[model samples]
Target: MIPVLALIVGVVLGVILDPTVPAAVEPYLPIAVVAALDAVFGGVRAKLDGIFDDKQFVVSFISNVLVAGLIVWLGDQLGVGGQLSTGVVVVLGVRIFGNVAAIRRHLFRA
Candidate 1:
């Protein structure tokens, strides 16, 4: 359920994240969403019998937003904020994949 919601949120966000469009505030959207997801989900690693762990969750959540923002900012400094955002989007794409996996597993559980 949560992962499905995240997917919906991601699509809406992706549409709103037009690289050609100029917005003063939209660039920070991903950071906020990622941070929120991390906070809400905590950590999710499959331990024995698929038990989840929170070790990397907290660390990665904080880092993703900060690093993604920093990467975008670096691109801005290098006169390529848009390009940097694209790259960061690629990175975030991994999370989207994970969400899909979770959603599928949850929905298809036997």
Candidate 2:
């Protein structure tokens, strides 16, 4: 609940502030966001499964974002940035969907 509220508040603040990402770094933003969300959903699933660990969650969150960004950066250097970004998004989106399904089953006994 708190995390969700914080996310909402953070998004609201970002919207209200309307800060812009630098052009150079903007390409990696979507991948990073998707990776961060994957971490979040994974954490929630872990919590629901009674194996939640704060240290693990934090590490996973940071690493996911960093690694996703790194992958995009590497792809850009290799001239395949868009392809890699799409691949990352698709993989993370699948994971997130799986996690959500698990969470729904856990909560609703479905």
Candidate 3:
């Protein structure tokens, strides 16, 4: 409940504020968002399964963002930023979809 509310508030604030990304950090933003969503969906699924841990959720969220950013940064250094960013998105998208599927099953029993 709190997480969902926070998400809503954050989205509302973001829309109202229309924050701009720094040019240097812009390339990694989308990958970080995807990673964060992957962690969020996983946390939600874990909550539904009765195994949600706040500590684990925090760690997962932070680590996902950091690691995804790191991977993109590294790819930039290697001149393969586009490819690595795509890979990160693909992997995280799979995890997000899997978690969402589990959550849907739990919620709807379908």
Candidate 4:
């Protein structure tokens, strides 16, 4: 609950402030977001399954963001940025949706 509130507040603040991202980081933002969402959903699923761990969640969140960004960066350097970005997004999106489906099943029993 606290983390969720913090995320909401952070988003609200970002929207209101309209902070500028460094140009060099612009390409990696979407992948980072998708990775973050994947971690969030995974955390939620763990909570539903009675296995939530704060340390694990924190580590997962940080690692996901870093790894996603690294992948995109590497892709850019390798001249295959677009293809790698698409692959990362697709993989993370699938995991996120799978976690969402698990959460829905747990909450709704449907």
Candidate 5:
């Protein structure tokens, strides 16, 4: 339920926003990576936090996002924005299916 609601909210936000908003705001966006990291992390206490301490998780998450962006960027650089978009869509489809399966298994147990 939360996942679906989140998706719906994201879709609505995207639909309502200017398509150029991300680019327009990109220069102003935080470099703090994930929101949770920005919200609760600071000082040596934050450094000792388990989530921040997990180097592998941070690396993996950053790599995944950058790889996806690089894919699109490469495609655009090579005059193939459509190809990059298709690649992004493909990954998104697979992710959505995986999320649905996991939720069904965990929540429905059938």
Candidate 6:
């Protein structure tokens, strides 16, 4: 509940502030977002499964973003950033979908 409220508030603040990200960090934003979403969904699913842990959630969220960003950064150095970004998104997207499905089943009992 608190996390959901905080997320909503963060989005609202972001929209109102309309902050600009640095140009150098722009390329990694999407990948980072997808990774964060994957973590968020995983956390939610864990909450529903009665296994939620604050430490685990924080670690997962930070590690997901950092690792995804690192992978993209490495790819850029190798001139394969776009491909790696796509791969990260695809993997994270699948995980997000799977988590969503589990959440849905838990919620809807379907």
- In candidate 4, stretches whose alpha carbon ends up further than 4 angstroms from where it belongs are none
Q: How much is the lDDT of residue 60 in candidate 1?
A: 69
C-alpha lDDT score of every prediction, in listed order: 0.62, 0.96, 0.96, 0.95, 0.50, 0.97
lDDT of 1 by residue, 1-110 (tens): 67669879988987898555347546766654654454334343232226554665556667766777777777778999887777667656666666656655665762
State the local distance difference test value for candidate 5.
0.50
How would you encode candidate 2's per-residue C-alpha lDDT over 1-110 as one tens digit per residue?
89989999999999999998999879988899999999999999999999999999999999999999999999999999999999999999999999999999999989
Q: Give the best candidate by TM-score.
A: 6
**Mind giving the per-residue lDDT tens digits that candidate 6 earns over 10-107?**
99999999999999999999899999999999999999999999999999999999999999999999999999999999999999999999999999
TM-score of every model versus the real structure: 0.54, 0.94, 0.96, 0.96, 0.49, 0.97
At residue 49, what lDDT does model 4 achieve? Answer: 97
Scored against the true structure, residue 39 in model 2 reaches a CA lDDT of: 96
Tens-digit lDDT track for model 5 on 1-110?
Answer: 56358758978987988366367335222221232232222212233332344565456556655665566566667988567657665655565455455545555675
Q: How far does residue 54 in candidate 3 sit from its true spot (Å)?
A: 0.4
Clashes of each: 0, 0, 0, 0, 0, 0
RMSD of 2: 1.0
Error of 2 at 90 (Å): 1.1
RMSD of each: 6.7, 1.0, 0.8, 0.8, 9.8, 0.7
**Could you give candidate 4's per-residue lDDT for residues 1-110 as a string of tens digits?**
79879999999999999989999899999899999999999999999999999999999999999999999899999999999999999999899989999999999998
Error of 3 at 104 (Å): 1.3
What is candidate 4's CA lDDT for residue 90?
Answer: 95
User: Per-residue CA lDDT of candidate 3, range 1-108, in tens?
Assistant: 787899999999999999899999999999999999999999999999999999999999999999999999999999999999999999999999999999999999
Candidate 5 regions with alpha-carbon error over 4 angstroms:
1-56
lDDT, candidate 6, equals: 0.97
